[model samples]
Target: MRKIAFIAFGIALWIFLTPTLEIEVLLTALIASYVAARLVGNVKLRPMKILNFTVLLAYNFLVAVWQSLKIVLGLFDYESKYFEEPAGRDFLEKFEKIVLITLTPFTIVVDEKENVLIIHELKRRKGTE
Candidate 1:
């Protein structure tokens, strides 16, 4: 019964994902279904948890794509600001660098001795803060 359910679910998933199907698609889906069922049979999943996780994943994906589009559209909105860094905040600086690298093509470094941060932006858009 469980095996039949897995095979049916796999076929449905393959049909939904592929625009056009072929003999190869059926063969691949059959094998994949068998393997996936064997691998995950021991694990139990809740539908609500899966739904929540899927929604979160979709939301994050859209946000990331939107950010990338804004960057491409030259919406480099920012403001020149200065702040006093707390002493022994190396971890904060490293985290900031990691975030900037992931979200933008920008390089930032903190000069602890001088208590200054140097931000190098790849491009600047006019009239952006």
Candidate 2:
């Protein structure tokens, strides 16, 4: 039910935002989920539950890496790439900003009992694995 509402909202938002919306309905939906989670409470993702997010995160990162590689190659062929002019300096700058923003990890901690959202840094170990 929550997911369905979110999807619908995203479609509406994408329609609202239109073509320039780089992420389209999906990003809108994801953002909606984050917002909803926050509104209700900090959503909890236990270690086991974390696996549920692994795939989507992995896919996003993989696509970002692939696009980054393409962007690199595009830069090399800037003189003849894009069928227009290849992505210009502005495009690269904007893309870098988007990727950097989108990929940064934000941990969502949920107060299950109170239904409140808390965003925090994901802790990392200093020692080697």
Candidate 3:
């Protein structure tokens, strides 16, 4: 099932990318997409999960962009300090932490034993340690 999806995704991607699907292109897309899909098979993500993840990623990206813009504008606005130490939550797995850090500026795994995450922000949210 996953293989089929991967093949389909690969072919679709290839078609969108290339104007003309030559024999070589077809073979290349099939092999590349299959290999890529197999590699990603470890993650075990379904179409709905992938879509949800994409939406979450986009939301986080937009939030990050907004935060970054606010920080940049602060340079001329004189609204607040440049650096801040916002509180962070501990993640169950290091992989999850890594994934989050990839998407957002915050969420760094400080210590594995203590499971501490450090979030960099202009200000810590109220009521959070």
Best by TM-score: 3
Query: If scored against the real structure, what TM-score would every candidate get?
Result: 0.40, 0.25, 0.44
List where candidate 3 sits over 4 angstroms from the true fold.
4-34, 40-43, 75-97, 110-122, 125-129
Candidate that scores best on lDDT: 3
Q: How much lDDT does each candidate structure score?
A: 0.56, 0.43, 0.57
lDDT of 1 by residue, 1-129 (tens): 666676666676666557678989888888998898787675444456445544554455456678678779987575443333333345434443434333443333334345444443444445655
Give residue 117's lDDT in candidate 2 (0 to 100). 24
Q: After superposition, how far is residue 8 of candidate 2 from its true place, in Å?
A: 35
**Candidate with more favorable, higher TM-score: 1 or 2:** 1
lDDT of 3 by residue, 62-96 (tens): 77777668658863232222322322353223444
RMSD of 3: 8.2
Structure candidate 1, residue pairs in collision: 78-129
Off by over 4 Å in 2: 1-49, 75-101, 104-129
